[model samples]
Target: MPGRFFLTDPMAAVADALNVEVGVVGNEPARRNIAPGQEIVVFDGALSRMRWGIVPVGRVNARGRPVMEQIINARSETVFDKSAFEGVGRAVIPVNGWYEWTGEKRRKTAWRIAPKGGGFLYFAAITDVWTAPGGMNVPQVAAVTCAPNGDVAPIHHRMGVLLERDDLTVWMGDDLDAAKALMLPSPEGRLEISEAGDVDWDGV
Candidate 1:
């Protein structure tokens, strides 16, 4: 699951790595426990946009609150037809690392999936903004998920659609075909999972 992750780097450092200007998230605090339904930053190769959490179709509203679904991850195989991410919702999240937990509830172990040098992990995601019945615009976004690679399968069955710095333009471009083709699991050794250092998940 891509349910919880961290963006430990400053906005400026992340922007430089993506070659995009640091937008509204100037000096924003690093997110240690990014969950669904909360606003997060995403990059589109050239521009950075802050995206709202996703709410799947048929559950747009829960009473007066935004219907938050257990949809932090999207399957790459059916992304085109999934009710939550049907049309055009291409986006990428440049987070430094993602967490996956194992073991029993009493003794869980959290693994931080990231690059060898602790570089960024440009997690592939999909986003959409549609007008509500009341004419209030609502934006929903979710990261894409694929079958875990060999290294990750032992820890978790699913992982986010990981991307490289060079693939930014194609992953976030207009050609849907090309983007979908890149939704496979990261290659073996492409990512390394280590026991996460002490982090304050509640700080976010």
Candidate 2:
């Protein structure tokens, strides 16, 4: 249930934290509701503008729209073998915090979860290149998800993969398998989450 999230800090701050030069996402507006299929900033020391969902080429609908099979989140266990993510579709997302919801099934309650001190977090993700409906090359990415660890488990069953500093190089390297291994749950004691100040699912 880890779906919506936020990136409150500027992309430059995130680059500083990752020890990489700030790339093209200069002074981007902080998104309080980051939905799929939109361009988002993701960098594993190489900040790039990546669309939110990964749509493999040649998999288009009857209308010629690229088919998106709910791939906004990839399972850590099967990310490598999944035919959809095997080639030219690996990436990482730099995020400060993400959102998860909990409440009665009929009435969803969205909560924002962030680090204790608002530090930067890099979420492991996969990317793909696709021709747009109008025949334009587009690159997109989705946050990798796994069984939550420590504190994030109680709020929801799934959590985005947050990478450690040392792992960034390998996570975004040439070896796909090596980067896939980094998709496992975040290291123990690496993250903390709390109830957001508000739980407004519909409000901005």
Candidate 3:
């Protein structure tokens, strides 16, 4: 599961890669250790980071209120059947690298999985709008995850479904079949792994 990521590219680079002119919503800075509930601007859309965990449709209060259970990652195989994802739309998240943990929890190792050429990866995702108690509504985003590929399996058992620039439209559109087809693991030799550096990304 991808709970955190880092995007070091500038807004111009992202826009240029997306082939867009200029503006995009929530243009945040490039940084490390971006956790859940943090906004990120991708090639396809600017996502208003979601709270982590999924809330079932039937999970309500005495008055039949909606709960805000959220999750950062959703299994590609089951996202279509998840109740919380009903009417969910798609979004893109551009990431340079994502981290994985190995060994014991207390003394685990952090590894970064990235493109072999040290470029960006466009991650496919599903999104929903969650309304707050009063009236505020925020978009919830969960990147689709599949079985780890040959390159990533050593560090983790799951990886985000990465898409090429050409597939963004299909993913964000109503082409269910085409979009689903893009949810496979990255091909062999598509990734590179390395130890993560300990940096105070908060200051970034």
Instruction: Give me the candidate number with maximum lDDT.
Output: 1
lDDT of 1: 0.76
- Candidate 3, lDDT over the whole model: 0.74
Q: Which pairs, if any, clash in model 3?
A: 52-70, 53-70, 53-71
Candidates by lDDT, descending order: 1, 3, 2
Tens-digit lDDT string for candidate 1 (57-159): 4533324444446466778888776444546567788888888889999798888887877778888888777566788766657788899899899999888
lDDT of 3 at 82: 52
Whose lDDT is higher: candidate 2's or candidate 3's? 3
RMSD of each: 4.1, 3.6, 3.5
**Residues 49-143, candidate 2, lDDT per residue (tens digit)?**
88887767665544666656746888888777655665655667877778877888987666667766668777888777777889888877878
| Per-residue lDDT of 45 in model 3 | 52
Q: Which sections of candidate 2 miss by over 4 Å?
A: 57-70, 198-204
**lDDT for each residue of candidate 3 in 121-140, tens digit (9 for 90 to 100):** 88888776666668676656
Q: Point out where model 1 deviates above 4 Å.
A: 45-52, 58-70, 130-135
Runs off by more than 4 Å, candidate 3: 24-27, 43-68, 201-204
Give candidate 1's TM-score. 0.85
